[model samples]
Target: MRKMILPPPPLFSALQQPAQHLLPYKTRKKGGGGRESARSSRRPQYCRDPAVHNALYTGDLQKIKSIFKDETTANLIIDSLAEELVWSAELGLWVLAPQKTHTSPLRITVSRGYRDCVKHLLLQGADVDAIVGGKAALHDSCANHRAECTRLLLNYSANPNILSEEGLAPLHLCTTQESLPCAQMLLEYGALVNQNTRDRRASPLHVAAKHGLDDHVKLYLCYGANIGHRNREGETALNSACASADKPEEAGRYYRVVKRLLESGADAQIAGRKNHTPLHNACSNCHIRIVELLLQHGADVNVSNCAGYTPVDCALHAVEDYLEGEPEKLIATLLNHGAAPINPKMLKFCVLSPRTMEVILNTYDRILSCDSWVEFVPSEVWQEHHVFYDSALCLLNQPRALQHLARCAIRKQLGIRCHQGIAQLELPSSLQEYLSLSLEGYLK
Candidate 1:
């Protein structure tokens, strides 16, 4: 292949220059030792030899030993070229251009989990802290979840807190459950447990919570991670956990993370971006268990976010996306926890979600004059759930039965304490279920 050498970007250009130019005169004048160290730290020259590339890519230990016999050879930047389609403004058409990339032997081996090759390179005096291709060998090891290589790099005195070109520390890249060991190793080697990314200001704890890595969160907490540390968006780890619990299959894992955060004294009502509390986030994702957990931890059920949306309102908006998650359970939980009855006009939001509509309707003592809900529901959905719809419409603008009236009266008297108060009453289990608005598939 033809060789294509492009000028490095400004960041790499700065890395290639001697450090003395950027330092104070007194520091620069220290000695030849400082000057030599600076020279050694400069970016290494690129190598386009196919023999060296093959030795590094295949992890050929003897071939690597023969080729990288010294520090300079081991640290030489390896160049790789590829063809990518680029839009040409002059030609007004797409054309193929040669794209050049750079990496070092240590980074290549470390990312591939070649422990033997990595040790050999490090033993040959490779710069453990060198930033090649915008990342150090340690970053590659952690990002690829190569625990053995990570341990080897750290043992060779690699800077555990080194940031990538994106300003993310090794801990920030430990986003998967499989990377938990790498994260633990980082923390044990004096990685800052609460280190924040340069751009987002999201700490390690926030990263763990956002991915629903409960064990990672537990480990970070044990290492004294700041659970309440807010990102640039002002979101605590708890808020991130709730907001990211969007997948129904992953809801349980996120629920556990949220529970751990709340148990660790996370402020349940703490608002984040857009003045949205964790409760608002949990409800908006239709995480019933998380919503209930937040409520039990004293999350304000009636709190409104920047958009003037209560938790119930957020839950209503989420009904369509989370119908399979039993969004009605979230609505019921919010109402039981003292959320004000949703505005009658907002009932349109849950019209398609029959169960959700039923829960909201059960909160009222008397059915109001609202026929527009019939029009909001799709014709096919209305036919599918005509039984529930017919029962609800029959009771519109009419007084409820004596049993429902009594249930509503008891629920109102208990107000926010409805759950505990009903449990305390000497009523039968059936009566308790009724008072709690347990659905019988239709309103009575």
Candidate 2:
């Protein structure tokens, strides 16, 4: 994978270096001669003059005009050296290397939103599509959200579909809400909405979904983005959105993104990396609303991922992080939707989450005989909910009451229709609550 390369800082002391030092190192005449010669030959040596560096960095129009008088000078490669900690395969350790980066006057000005300087360079016959340092001027302009510069470059015949060295098109770099206009320009100039990254095969839709960019997602869908396109990991845009819905504060945004994708005909059960469906991802992150949304859209409740874990299993595993999210609601929702009961052996994950444990336990006619879960619960949590813990332990090896058994029988007969069937039963509200495994603070 290509590491992110930061733009070069100001070149105050960089130009003071000796000219010979600025050039690519000469081939070593001794050991590893062929490899050294080939490596040196591929490195482009460019002008490192301080005056041109200042002119481009500061957006000095007249100075830029003087320095770049012709097409060759207009596209002159400016080299900057910086010490980067790079992993050395030979030594098996990280070491500092003086890395030389190359960029052109057009790239510098476009990246900084210096439109006049960019216009001057372009008028001087600067190559708008010239890829120095693995990116064209259009890539920088889009990445930095320089909409005007991006429009100017596209008008000058910059390739909107150009891919960076990292195999990402400019559309893929429109990751923020502010980059919306840049993305619009790319699409207007013939950028492929479904262009996949060379490595991950992730389209701009996947990128936008992963970042929870609802506006970008809306735009892409309108521009004919393939909603079902999967990346190398087999994740569709919906899967990407669910997997990244980790922050509770950001849940609303992700929920909207997922809802929009579903509305656009995204498959809810399409599994991705590790064969995890969007339902699995939503459950694992304890995104209750998204989980409900997915189920409403026909997401399968009992689908298993590559690890043989069902959506309920994923929810159980995430209890620790989402105790405050009312994980019991998610567990109850899954059961109501006909999800298979979680294996008794996996109950340890919910020991600290008494309400979650209660919901899972309520699914069975008889509580499974598992004493190990008690040890996993911290003493503080046990103390906080001693009544529920005590009641649960007392019933571990005992048969549930006849009333509970009847409730279980009704739920079993209803099967996947538990939610709707119970509502239609015309039972009293208290009985309905009991049938739904509503937490009563202690086992009945």
Candidate 3:
């Protein structure tokens, strides 16, 4: 992974020491036999250049006015004021918090890990957690891996939890390819264990886990992250680990994080959307081992997603299930692990077997009649979701929700589609048939 190289300070100047000598620059000599050749020409220095300094710190017109009241001011005026403002701000922050600054100082001599500069600013007066362009100075120190600077920020009472303008804290910046030492420093400074970004709900755990950073995960967990906390999608840290995203390295990182969560006693059975649990997600992705581990850890086999599909049912039917292993082992594992009985009705529903609609509509009757099967699941789990009611009701003349009811002369009752996939699901056999017929008008 490449490290993030931050740009030069906000007040960047194009002033290079101009060539003192009127000649072309010499390129470094290729591997040569000469030990010492000649002294290099020194570049000319441009001092107290005001226009350049104004453009560097903030190209904003207001900022320019605040620093140099007159645009026509001499170079010395601009230079001196700009320097003073930078130092004053630095001092204000340092006396307040030695280690923290809202923004990096604009100095002729840029401070990189300058321990004394940080301390000087703090003792003289500076707010450690001051905001600059909506950023914390600690962010800059960390981004550059200036460990000494970071130490000062911590000493001065910088709030590690304060996210910067870009939604990054010292901890987030430390995760970049640069700033390992800065990350360690923030870790030492009492940064939150699972810091979250302001723009999104991803915790530091999510980022570290996504990057496959086992070390980072260890660091975050040690600091404090609720491994089971659900993000917007209601997915816990373990659920994120099992997602098959386009990035393999990221996926691997999540997998490692999931392993850690499990070891730490994360509850995989804490169910989520469409009723899917971590075990179901594990099975869906063909992570058979993860599925098994989840089951071993008390994952519910019969807990169905909103689609009313059980863990084994999802494994047996999703197009990708074959990637992990064959079906027989999956069935055996689920059964031995206390799966609901696999009756004819369940067989059709679980794998979408070739049961006619006639058989499916009557399947509920068969299950409730069987005392052995009723003990395993709610009668509704195997039945198409329905509501039956009232001696005077009739399926043909009722409200929309009661249309699914069967109207027999023996009695009048209302039944409705509750949570069943029976309404929208298309069996494999109907897929080609629909495409073949829908595209043609002959069926009409």
Q: Find the candidate with the highest TM-score and give its number.
A: 1
Per-residue C-alpha lDDT of model 2 across residues 1-444, encoded as one tens digit per residue: 124444555564444232343333222233322213332433333677778788898999989888788665775678777666767778887776667877878899999999999999988867666667788888899889999999998887777887888898999999888999999999999999999999999999999999999999999999999998988988999999999999999999999999999999999989999999999999999999999999999999998888899999999999999989999999999999999867888889999889998888888888767675877989999999999989988997798889889989999999999988999998899999999988888886
Q: Model 3, which residues run further than 4 Å from truth?
A: 1-130, 140-157, 165-168, 172-183, 194-203, 244-252, 312-444
Model 2 error, position 426 (Å): 1.2
lDDT of 1 by residue, 1-444 (tens): 233344443221212322223211111112221212344334356677777777787899999999888876777776667666677778887777868676889999998999999999988877787777788888889889999999998887777898888999999989899999999999889999989999999999999999999999999999998987999999999999999999989988998999999999999999999999999998889888998888888899988899899988899888888878888877887887788978888888888789888888888888876665778989999999999999988998888898988888888999999878989999999998888878888888
Highest-scoring model, lDDT? 2
lDDT of each: 0.84, 0.86, 0.49
On lDDT, the stronger of 1 and 2 is 2
The C-alpha TM-scores of every prediction are 0.89, 0.88, 0.44
Measured with C-alpha atoms, the lDDT of residue 199 in candidate 3 is 69
Candidate 1 has its poorest 10 consecutive residues by lDDT at 22-31
At residue 191, give the lDDT of candidate 1: 98
